[model samples]
Target: MRNASIHPRTLGYLGRALSLEYSAVQQYMTQAALAEAWGLRDAADRFRHETVEEMQHAERLIKRMLGLGVAPNASQLRPAGLAYGLVELLLQDAALEAEIVALYDEATNFCRRIADTENAEFFNALLQDELQHAAEIETWLESLGVARRTTEDERAYF
Candidate 1:
């Protein structure tokens, strides 16, 4: 492996991100399969599209790691929860996206602190992507008359 000149923490974050991206790919694909089994054609298609997008994210992270002379690690994976219904799936996806967005935001801050503007920008872009996904999921959930979380609940947390 080529010597990655970046800080160790930066490398650690990138590796974690790579692992998460791979996990997302697996999760989305599995969701797609489950949707198909449940005869939810539209949901299945959306999940498949999400699976492809997650794969693309993983590929980009791997390429970036390799470019930095670091080997990408995908070992830090967790089991993807198989939601019971369409509404559950949307809620799960929204939560997952929110988690990823927070992680990427932290990574972006770390990159900026280390003066790696390029990586910081990359992480920021990922954050935006995830935020959009989260918003879409929330909208769909609301349209389906499923309440993942109420605004009052959020207010209580603050």
Candidate 2:
């Protein structure tokens, strides 16, 4: 692909994605430290793993932006969602994963609509990964007896 011109909206989506991914990395890293301080070593390790995964996602987004000849700037990163307990952190993570899933899904659809197979495939991969992460979190919640189908006003666990 020589001298390619990426659509502005697509760039917007990519930037938004990079921001969310980096935010997730921050969230998970903070949660990991919190868990460690609380003496939940296993939970801390799990969050650390999540941090790495989210970091990988951000890296991929940066690479994609560069491939499209754009500066890889994650526009804004949200504050890390913090909680005192492991379950609370997991709940926050589940909600974040839901948001990521929606973003990737929408981005993938937009790319497909514009007949950009490469970008569509990229977004779809991220979508699949986030979906799996969401499912794992849901299962973890279930295992801990904290899983509940959320009400209309609540963030969904599924």
lDDT scores in order: 0.81, 0.88
Q: Count the backbone clashes (under 3 Å) in each candidate.
A: 0, 0
Model 1: per-residue Cα lDDT over 39-59, one tens digit each: 999989999999988888888
Over the stretch 5-105, how does candidate 2's per-residue lDDT look in tens digits?
57788899999999999999999999999999999999889989999999999999988888888888897999997776878888988888888988998
- Looking at candidate 1, the ten consecutive residues that score lowest on lDDT are 149-158
Candidate closest to the true structure, highest lDDT: 2
TM-score of 2: 0.91
- Give the C-alpha miss distance for residue 94 in model 2, angstroms: 0.6
The TM-scores of all predictions, comma-separated, are: 0.90, 0.91
Best by TM-score: 2
**Cα shift from native, residue 66, model 2 (Å):** 0.5
